[model samples]
Target: MSVGDGRRPEPRYSRIVGELRRRIESGELAPGERVPSTREITRQWGVAMATATKVLTELRHEGLVRAVPGVGTVVSAPERATAHAPAPTAPAPTAPAPPAPAAPVRRSTPSPAAAAGSPGGLTLSRIVAAAVTVADAEGLTAVSMRRVAAELGVATMSLYRHVADKDDLLVRMMDAAIAERPLPADPPPGWRAPLDVAARQLWGLFRAHPWLAPAMSLTRPQLITSAMVYSEWVLGSLHRHGLDDQSAFTAHLTLLNYIRGLALNMETEREAEAQSGLDSEEWMDTQEPALRETLEGGRYPQLARLSRAGYDFDLDGLFEFGLQRLLDGLAVLLDEGTPPTRA
Candidate 1:
């Protein structure tokens, strides 16, 4: 904190920026070196995302870093240094550094009238499509009306012509995303087949669009037609298996939650990949040393054995395994003729 300024101490983000500046200026973080991402800054400093963002913004203002496409913000090469420090008047030659995982900042100029579909011509499909593209590429946090409008090159208020607000936009986006993958026209002729297809199909949807799983809710489910498709299939499947209304519905919920629960990781993984720019295997490779150290420590014998077993750790395989086991349990439940009604 700055003392005796007759003003409040430096804002938290400014403090964070100062620390980052020290690292960059002192050659500790070399020009073109990757710095902590907003998520990482939040974690290391125990601050909110907005604060972390502010820190990056301040650093940018000081010309301490430059944003690179597909590569996150990096320390600018010395010649390009536009910080308060004196200009060197020459570019310092350095080999290129590896790309880091900073997500794209949407910097597109609001497209000209020719490119941006007419506000008068705005359709619900176009709006939802644009919003989904934003969410899919940048995650759900990037999808505000202003951002969407910027994306579509229309005025922000123009979006209200189709959707009521952001919440309504999200609901429509979810519905549209789900509807894109329609249910199978031909049935497999039995209860288990449809359930398996529904579960796998939903999983695929979540995998394709990680933002999807969290956009939905179970308790206060959105009244969207596409969402009802899976639920109806699951409930009807169980009922066809000789389960009652309460049991069938509960079973459907459990199955949906199971898929939804696992799918939640997709978003988390999506985010980590976005911020780190590493896929699952690549990220795991980066952590191999720490993983090996823990495995060798003997504190987690079972983990060590599993690590030694050399599993591929495929999410799809895991999903299918759980689905089959769940169905097997349901098979046993059905054999019981019917579960007892509670008093």
Candidate 2:
């Protein structure tokens, strides 16, 4: 029977294997080039880890890829047939009108407009803008150096003049995105209002680029100058409460970590929905029956009451609640010189 005529068709892993095979055979991905990792396959193709791993394993079994100790899985030389093949022969008699010289195929280079360079040409900013546009549309997994170069209509090696590698390009994208945000020129009235405004502004930035939350590092914090300026704003706000430099810095770090952690959850939720084909509402709906059954049993009375109250548990509400409580504790310390109450 045909695929949709009754038979359930071959497994998804088989399809993945076939596509990768075609890419190798068509010379789109060259021999010795690294194959997509299991994590990459899962993210790019929206498949489970097991399915992605199975696809790679099947390719390896077919001798298409071999795992090199230091280099990871790379396309094998046996799979390089299309790369070295000669072009097909044309009919001889029909073409012989006159002994005309063949016209040269004009190769295109990266234009200064595309690369956003000065009169000299090809700056890092142009390369990063191109990369960011790709990631914004297709998600972060699509933002490779080669992909960015393709978007810029340049040789991949030409990108190296602007960016060191993919990692460098990502860092530059983060900085550029951060630079677009405008922090307060001067502090607003009181510590509460300015801090609230700053936090909300950063949160808005994450909402604009949902992928960015996970890309940032709180501990090693990418050191983007604009991001640092915002951090300084937060630190300065905390200083108004009479906290010393170290205390102020610690408070700033704590607030940043909280925001980043929550924003990462939001990013993960989006990715999970995209990959699983189940949106947040659908996922929650599936869980509701089981959750209702459990809550109705009433093993924990207080928890049951809260669940019955229909709390939506929104992230914004949670953030506001937590921030106010934290600031209240700080207020207590400021007012009475006593230890603040800890939840």
Candidate 3:
């Protein structure tokens, strides 16, 4: 929204509406073509969810788009006969334009348009937030500088003034997402307790933001300081158990990889759901007949038995079950007082 300080800055939502309107009018987005969803609008424009909704709301009020329940918002089909009719002798008066978007907020943090050299407001927080929002909602593939800038209601080059490029921006995004939650100040007593606590915390984070698991590399993970903090927590738990440096480090990686391995499926499953328009349970139901047939073969008696019963396939259940069994074996080493290196 604009201030009364003489500048008639358009509201952020208006800017978004203008762009989408242009797309609709220019046939860039054809009739029945899906316009950006509210979530996409939020990510593409560094505006609040309400602003994104307003963008769609305005477009809809103007007869530019309409929402379809199962599908999504799409451009409204023009009335062909009326559209081709001769123009009236007198033109309709133009409605006043909305308030222009307020001057980009200059922030010390990247909230919107922070000055590059400013102490804490180094890069554009709005851009990063939009990018992260996109990755969180639609996966990393949907994020791009053009997309981010458009989301911010700014020119594409405007982002370069804040973020270096996509790679640098992605690393910054990783830091921002991972740092969303702080680790516990004090871990619970016992190596197992702390280990469980740490692993579950990471699991929840990955589950909440499925894109995160794919954002980092196992071999050459992004140097996200927030991410390393969790590693330190897990490694410290091992150190207290008298595991040597290598053993502790190895254990840390093992536990991390374990969590990440399962967490990767969260995004995969999400992508599958989006593409197929079926949730996990719905999708699994479709496969039941095939699964039963495969299991009925004489070669797999144990599988056939389990197939008769149903499974939840709960990711959390899977994580806890595997974690306990792995810890049970690790506890053996701890009880025997043998370092992993020695084993």
Candidate 4:
């Protein structure tokens, strides 16, 4: 559709990409010159973080820019063959130009921390710590080799010496974080006591690192030794309760999944707040009128009564409530001396 014809405009990222491409091609942003970071783009363009991220991605896809770890995203150096070649003719405006194939990014040599001017030099521990800090402050989506390198004041390739890749860095971060709260040296004697302690400790870990709960998985597991300590504690407690190996492991997983299920809400709520600039309470307040109208239909008496009386949806309180109920069910099973067993 024509501009005046009621067609929606091109995506915000497309426009940003075009502008940046023009700058790079015109030598305004010369080769190796830093381009706007996602945060900068958001501030300059008055756009959301996702949109800003898309702009950078589009630039990278077009081979107009590349991420340089510690230096940030920069204009890509022109290929020797194209260095003096005439500019290609613009595609007909009848339809948008097809996306150009992305060129492989060139990795710069890794520099030693001392050479990079990092005080006290870099260590694997420092790398993991910095990555965790990034994940905690921003969502997991914000963590990248380039971002972490920028955080640590070292070349992106330097991280590879300590961490094999981003996935490896994530595992190291998870292990480092879980190690912060070790299982008690002298755990309480009872099976229930130990299980309670482990669950609460895991809860605390998830609370401190919102990205953690979502990053961790029961089905597709990561090899986090500190996390294994929790598993060992939980499994041992279940075994003492007279469950067989399979049943004990299964029960341990059940309890873990329960805590992880509730913990997921923390990250989701944080992301929602960041995007909407409204916390859970404020968001709910905004929806109160709609909630009230829905309740007025009289289809859900219990919900209407609770809404009228006012209920606080506290995650911590809810976790405690659910924990006790789960323990109660396990208690009944143990008391009956008929712990669940596979047929």
Assess every candidate by TM-score. Answer: 0.63, 0.60, 0.61, 0.64
Question: Mind giving the per-residue lDDT tens digits that candidate 2 earns over 1-343?
Answer: 3866887878889888889888865657666677786656877789976677778777777777764322345676652234333232442122112111111111134353545344346667667777766665456877798887777666788888777788888888888776766786888887867877888777766655666778898767776777888888878777777878887787777777777777776667656766875444335446767887998876978888886654444565666777777666666655644454454
* Cα-based lDDT for every prediction: 0.73, 0.67, 0.69, 0.73
Candidate 4: tens digits of C-alpha lDDT, residues 1-343: 4899888998888888878887877667766677877657877899976787778767776777764322346676564113332253552112111112101111133233533565447678777777777787677989999988887678788888888999999999889878878888877887888989999888877876778888997889999999999888888887876878987887788889999899888788778877886544445556877998999999999999998766645567778888877777777766754454321
Worst 10 residues of 4 by lDDT: 97-106
Q: How many clashing residue pairs are found in candidate 3? A: 11
Evaluate residue 215 in candidate 3 and report its C-alpha lDDT on the 0 to 100 scale: 81
lDDT of 1: 0.73
Report the lDDT of model 1 for residue 172: 91
Return the clash pairs for model 2, or none.
none
Query: Ten-residue segment with the worst summed lDDT in candidate 3?
Result: 94-103
- Give the C-alpha miss distance for residue 198 in model 3, angstroms: 1.1
**Model 1 — TM-score against the truth?**
0.63
- CA lDDT, candidate 1, residue 59: 77
By TM-score, who's the top model here?
4
lDDT of 4 at 213: 86
- Specify the highest-lDDT model's number: 1
Ranking by lDDT: 1, 4, 3, 2
- Candidates 2 and 4: which is better by lDDT? 4
Residue-level lDDT of model 1, residues 1-343, one tens digit each, is 3587688877788889989988877668877676776656877999986687778767777888765322356787775566554455465444342112111222234354643665567778777877877887788988899988878778888778888999999999888778767787765766878888998788867765678898889888887899898778778777876889998888788888998888887777767777886544445546767898988979999989986665545466677778887877777777844343222
After superposition, which runs of candidate 3 have C-alpha atoms over 4 Å from their true positions?
1-123, 336-343
Judged by lDDT against the true structure, how good is candidate 3? 0.69
